[model samples]
Target: MSSDEEWSSGEDDSQPSKLVRKAREAPFVPIGLAGCLTLVAYGLYKIKDRGNQKLSVHLIHMRVAAQGFVVGAITIGVLYSMYTDYVNPTSSKPKK
Candidate 1:
């Protein structure tokens, strides 16, 4: 009998076992990159609105808005990273 036929004919439990094994092995690089990108974008947006400021009050308002945007972006990034890493680690990495 052919090797493929022999392997497929067996009523083994290795399929589920292999899936379980793979579920335990994954990387977190993408999660980290996503977080860093979010922070960088926030920083850029926060700093890019400081042009042609005619009054101190306007400048202060801009600064406060910028800070809020940055903080919100960072918080979202961190929460997403943690969720992806802990709640669904298997989908975080691709199979090689």
Candidate 2:
């Protein structure tokens, strides 16, 4: 699959990932991603303007990888919590 196909967004014309299509899909995924990007930008700023300033080709992919990691982590966490709360029902109270 093409790069776009593999990472298509729900808001775009193309289809989104299955992880994003789930009922409990995080609405704030992009917001969390924005936070990652902001951190990356700040890192770039610090590395470029303040430190060694030597840019590397790998740094360009940092945004993509970090955002994916953030979204994936959140998705997994949500699914796990849903499973534990709804499917297993691990409360202290006894069932009537």
**Top lDDT: which candidate number?**
2
Positional deviation of 45 in candidate 1, in angstroms? 14
Model 1 lDDT per residue over 1-96, tens place: 766553443455488865554444422333444455665566456565757754575656655655555566657766777887899888777989
Question: Candidate 2 residues 1-96, lDDT tens each?
Answer: 766556546565334555566523454566566668776876676664544434664475565766776787678767766776788876623878
8, model 2: CA deviation in Å? 26
Off by over 4 Å in 1: 1-54
Q: Rate the local accuracy (lDDT) of all candidates.
A: 0.58, 0.62
Please report how far candidate 2 places residue 27 from its true position, in Å.
3.7
Please report, as a residue range, the 10-residue window in candidate 2 with the lowest summed lDDT.
49-58
Q: Model 2 clash tally?
A: 0
